[model samples]
Target chain A: MIEIDNLSKKFGDLTAVDSISMNINEGEVFGFLGPNGAGKTTTVRMLCTLISKTSGNARISGYNIGDKDDSLKIRKIIGLVPDNVGLSEHLSAYDNLEFFARVHDLSKTERKERIQYFLEMLGLWDKRNVSVGTFSKGMKQKLAIARALIHDPQVLFLDEPTANLDPEAAKTVRDFILDLKKQKKTIFLNTHNLDEAQRICDRIGILNTKLVSIGTPKDLEDAVRVRKTVIELEQVTDSVLKSVQKLSLPNLDVEGNTITFDTIDSGSKNWPIVEAIVHAGGHVNIVKVVGSTLEDVYLKLVGENQ
Target chain B: MKLSKAWLVAARDFKIFKHQKNMLYGLVIFPVIISIIPSAILNYAVNRDPPLPAAGIPPILDAFSIFLIIGSAFVPLGIAGYTIVGEKVEKSLEPLLAGPLTDGEILLGKTISAVLPALIAMYTGGVIFMVGTDAVSYPSLNYYYFPNWTIAVILFLGMPAATIMSVEFGVIVSSRVNDVRSATNFGALMFFPFLIIYILGQTKLITLDTETMAKISVILLVIDVVLFFISTALFKREEILTKWK
Candidate 1:
């Protein structure tokens, strides 16, 4: 539901967001992953119409972001959760939601219903009356999420939504994101957490070479064979050594206590490593097959680009 | 529909003011306090029989005029400073920039908030001072302090210009600075010349007669027009978001 074409934002000599291009389909959770200062937030801001694109264009829901008529229309269609949450800490959760609802021009009944529903869903109903200044980091974050969804925009742009949250709060946000996907809302998430992106995103794009790779997790694994296989021995004895030495898997590399091999069969071919160790009189403790992760792809793309 | 947004913004500002005790006092009660000091000083000097100024309006009228200029000067400075810098401190500027409202709308909303309360407090102080001083003075001194067209122009053109200038400068200053205090202090620096003119004119140390007021008003009108355009030009949303340092 979004189209970006050669989107580049320059502040004098410094190019915050280099020439980047990507398309996000409706109902797809597209993860825009990058390290700090990697232009992820800038890209989101440009798409959200908060900042202008220095060159090129971005269209949201088929409306050009550069066009004023389409910009307002686009604004109504998308909801943005900024990186900092940027919430008014002194205002109560309910008040904050009410303010944004009014800004979004929701009818009173629609606003009330949505606020109540989202607040309850995010487990912030009890704290709705209290000021956000008094809330913990997690509570404030939940309120920000509720605020973003108050108007129920068709597309949601989330920036570091789970940045500083505890594990439970992070999981709560992730689960809510998954729930959004279930409801078929197009979500554009910018995050440093590769795992969260991999878990929640339908297609992930690492922002190294601007539009490095865009596809499902398995598609990424298939395209980039950066997988890992580890065979754990019950005892690091000489038999364990002989067994590992005997199996000459293609593209294999081994170091102390760790052996990594490249196999065309991805994650399902870990049984051979276990079988080899066991047949050579070595006690196999556990075997794990680590597939190519978004992190690995991210590192490889960014590293290669550098 | 736009009024609704403006009111929403005003309410949001008021909610912020509720938390900012010092700022609430700065905008509302502190102007009154500053007014009271002069009132108290005049009361002390007069000691039940006030001295009439030889050149122009009565001392009470002079005091009210001084109050007007002071109110116009300080009220907008304090309110506008808090309005712009408060948003910066609270990190609300990004949302405002991201929202549907334009820079003019946001600036007008803040200017009105500052101007409205200032006019109210100034008028209230004038009424209270006139009544209180009349009880202690001659019958000839009792007079109406209705803002003339000249004063109206000052209130209309001057208050808004001062507010706009202050807020624009505050926004720029706050954008560069970290917190409200430094921005407010930096913003307050812009009001010095006006304060000097008001002080000198009010004390009769250098009379800003009707002719001077007109000239000054005309000059301010031109300056206001220029500053209005300049402020708008300076208000580049992308520039701000990108070069916020």
Candidate 2:
């Protein structure tokens, strides 16, 4: 688990992360989303103990982040996959993993088992002997992921883990993350892909140099407050149209036996309108709610702050 | 500090060195070339028709021997100069820094890796030069000028100290600089002090006696200590991660 309070970082006149605070629970996948220069990486760096915070405090696995003595303890429990893959190009994939494994002081047996397990799981076992410089971008990214997991840290920080991968490779990484979650590993994922975040993250934090919003995907979508009810009808008779118009829903439009109307209260208003249309002798094909997606909520939240 | 962690780092660096053709050439071949040049010159001079004066043995041989020892310093300068900055340029520093290893451990590990090969190469060069000089000068002098106290001090005490000092200087420069070329250029400056010592000895201002060698070794050991502390102080992890750009 990770906790932060009023954590901020400043570079002279520029504040890269401005007094943002959040807690990540054990075994929860937390997605950190933001645009360019949005302090996502800065926050992750502070938590990883890679950089000192200019102000505020944080703790990882119950160790204080600001305390110098606790830095080693914190590092022992956390792993980071930075935006750059950060693999030693000339070293073999196995050599690279072996070096980090030694740094963490893993036993010989543990190191061997963990290296082979991660390599196979990430689909990199065959290429373990090959130098990392010859690996493709997707393979390199996977190796970085494996490197981060080499020590089996309590928390894993992945910055843009799937940035350069093909769709299939991206799915592989996503599935691997989901597997990590199943095994009760806490993950702090900083990503630009909203769909990936929505699919995997139990909770999402939207940041723009500050904490704009943090909640589950559904919770965020429900918070957007823009709703539309779409009704598909088999026939649009004049009587049914008049009966539906009697409800006087706002922003109503009809085209080709389909009607769409804006409603701030879709939950209550949709059923009533559906009943009125069916009673008025119009065959109802389908009725659905629209206009609230994670993308929509993200754009609205980020756009409003901007 | 954690000795095992430091040793692991050193081992990794050595593995990388084995794969780097340029670094291998600098470590093994460069010192050989530096030693051969002076040894060849000494051989030609001693075997000349009249044979150079036997009195010239101490100064000429001493100067070339000092040159051979000083040449070892450059091996570390060329290789260790790139250790930190090269990792930064390659984007490998983050993963290393993210580990539990402290700054001192990382620095000491790199110093060991750099100094080990340099000392080996220097000792190898010293042996080759001694054999070549002894073979050529045997008839005239009928005595070996090497394996003496001064050369012993230079090889055992002075060379290691200079190599360590050079390595620490390179790490210091590598920590602050943004590129390998600049760090190496700054590391090249480490040779000037040894150059000064060689010049003083050649000018007869400082004789190549055991007493003088003792004093020089003490001075180099002192410098080595001072540079080690200063480099350790300058190697701040936050500055390297944030400010180097």
Candidate 3:
């Protein structure tokens, strides 16, 4: 579990992370979401004790990050995967893991077994002997994950784990996260990928200058009250646009050729607008009922904070 | 676990050195080249018309000692320069910092690790030059090439002090500077004092006799102790990593 209270990290006039407070329970996959420079990485850095907080406090696995006595315990309990994959590029995948295994104090047998298992699990067994410099970006990421998990840490702090991965590689990382969840490992994931957050995270926190919102995806959507109704017409004529606009959606915006409207009524659907567009000599090309995505809520919250 | 982890980092650096042996020339070969320069000068002096005063230990040792002093500057610049900056370059520093090791521990590990190989190589070269010079030029080996307490003081006290000072300065430079090369070049400035001392000793302008060497060793050892604590204190995790310049 992780607890942060009014934690603020400032670099001169720039406040990287402002008085942000949140709690992540054990076994929860908490997604820390934000845009670039939105303080997601800074918060994780503070939690991992890589950078000290200018104000307030954070406790990881019941050990206060600011406390010297509990520093080692906190480090032992957390596995961190930074946004950039930093490995001993000259060392083979196996050697890198072996080295970290020793640092983590795993016995020879345990180290070998865990290294083999994680390498095989990450599909890196065959390439174990090759220097990491020879591996692709995805392979390096997988290796980084394996290194992080080598110590069997209680909490995993991942900063943009799959930022630049191909879809397949991203899915592999996702599957690995799910596997960690099965092992009851708590994950503190910092990511800007809203869809990934929605899919993999149990709860999410939107961070701008600070912790702006924290909830499940649905809870965030509800809090922001974003509706998902697809409106399609044969021709997006003036009359059709006027009629669609008159649908009285509270928060509405035009995105390209499509008009997305956020309505207050939970039961109100896009059918009436479709009918109105058709009556106005426009055909509904695409119509589907959807819900507010994590992105919608994230942008809204970030906008409000700004 | 901490000690082992420190060694692990050290070993990893060594392995990486082996892989990219060429890049290590600045550290590994520079010391040898520095030693060889003095050896070459001594070789010429022995063969010259007016022979240099006190050939073997006096002249060659002076050159070798100066080599060490200058080489000490480069060792820290090489090791400490690359320690943090290399991580930043390869983007591995964050994860390393995330480990349980404190800044002092990490620096200690890296400092000892980087210093050992360079120092060992230089010491071997120095000994070989001493023996080689004794064999070729000396009428007898006993008096000219004896292993005196001065030699011990130079190796144990003088060398380590210079090494630590270089590493400390290098770390401070690396923290503030963005580029590793720039940090290293800037850090190399620490060698100027040692170079000046070496030149003065060589020209007989400053007497670097056995007694003077011992005195300098003690003085340098005290300086090293002070600098070590200062470097550790200035290396505040909150200050360098989180704070802005």
Candidate 4:
């Protein structure tokens, strides 16, 4: 579990993260969404104790990030895959994992078993001996994830874990993340891939140098939900448009026999509009509510901040 | 500063160095070439008709030993220079820093890795040079001149002090520089002091006796300690992660 309270970071005049606060429960997959320079990486670094936060505080698994005494304890429980994969290219995949394993102070037998398990699970067992430079971008990312998990840390911080990977490779990483979630791993994922976040995150936080919104996907979507109804017709007539207008819909517009309008109450207003259109002798093809998506919510939130 | 973790880092660096041909050349081949060439020249000179005047050993052999010791000190320059900056460029520093190891531990690990091979090569080259000089000067001097107290002092005290100083300097340079080339070029400057010492001893401007050797060793040890503290102070994870370009 992680607790962030008034966490802020400033580099001289520029504020990277501004008093953002949130709590991630145990086993929760929390997705941190942000644009470039939105303090996503900065937040993760502060949490991992890689960099010092300019103000405020954070704690991982009850260990304060600002306390040097708790640094090793915090580090022992967390793993980070930074924006860059950061693998030792000259070393083999196994060697890379071994180095991390040793740094975590895992015993030889434990390190061997964990490395074998993670590598095999990530489908990297066969390429364990090959230098990481020879691996594809996806393979390196997977290896990085494996390295992060080699010690079985309690919380995993991944920054753009799938950024630059092919679709298949990204899917593999996403699947692996899902598997981690199943195992009750607390994952703090910083990603631009909205679909992946929507698919796997138990809760999501949208940030643009500040916490814009944090909730379930549906909750975030509803916060920025646009109440509009779209109606399709087999044929449109002037009478149909006039009849729909008479229903006092907000922002009424007609395009190529399709009518779109905003309504305060889409659930109740849609039926009357459909009946009015039917009364005007227009054949009804479809009537549907336009619900907001995570992308829409993200763009709306980010766009407003800009 | 968990030494086990530090050792892990050192062992990993050593493993990587094993596969690096350029580092191999610097560590093994370079010292051998620099040592053997001078030893061969001395051997050739001593075998001449007149047989260069010898009391115990030729003065040129002592000069060659200093040269070889200094040469061995340079071996770790490239290695230490590449340690921090190279890992930063390769993007490997992040995960390593994110680990439980302290900055001191990581620096210690890298220093040990770079220093060990360099000291080994220096001693190995010293032995080879000694054997070659003794073999060639045998007809004239009739005895082995190496393994003297002065040479022992140079090997055990002076070389380690110099190597540690170079490694500390390299770590400092590597932390500040963005690239290995810049780090290496800057770290190579560490050699100048040792070079000056060698030159002074060779010219007889400074004696190569135990007293002079002790003084130089003490000076180098002090420098190494100061530089080590300076480097450790500068090796902050925040500065490296944020300030480095």
Output the lDDT of residue B22, model 4: 79
TM-score of chain B of 1: 0.75
Against the native complex, each candidate's DockQ, computed on alpha carbons, is 0.58, 0.65, 0.64, 0.78
Candidate 1 deviant stretches above 4 angstroms:
A229-258, A264-290, B1-3, B48-64, B133-137, B140-161, B202-205
Steric clash pairs (candidate 4): none
What's the TM-score of every candidate structure? 0.87, 0.88, 0.88, 0.92
Q: Between candidates 1 and 3, name the one with more favorable DockQ.
A: 3
Per-candidate local distance difference test: 0.71, 0.85, 0.76, 0.86
TM-score of chain B of each: 0.75, 0.93, 0.85, 0.93
Backbone clash count for every predicted candidate, in the order shown:
1, 0, 1, 0
Per-residue lDDT of A1-306 in model 1, one digit per residue for the tens? 899999998877888877888899988999888778788988888887877888989888788988766766777778888877778877889988998898888999998999899888877788888888888777677677778778888788899999988998888778888888899999999998988988999888878536667788768766777766776665656776777767777667656556667654656667777777777787766667777776677788777766
CA lDDT for candidate 1? 0.71
Stretch of 10 with least lDDT, candidate 1 chain A: A255-264
Best candidate according to DockQ? 4
The fnat of each candidate, in order, is 0.49, 0.80, 0.69, 0.92
lDDT of 4 by residue, A218-260 (tens): 8998888776788899988988988987777888888997888
Question: Worst ten-residue run, lDDT, model 3 chain A?
Answer: A262-271
DockQ (0 to 1) for model 3: 0.64
Better of 1 and 3 by lDDT: 3
lDDT of 1 at A127: 81
What is candidate 2's lDDT per residue for B5-73, written digit by digit as tens?
888988988877877777778787766876677667877887788878888877787777676557767
* lDDT tens per residue, model 2, A183-226: 98999999989999999999999999989999999899888867
Ranked candidates (TM-score, high to low): 4, 3, 2, 1
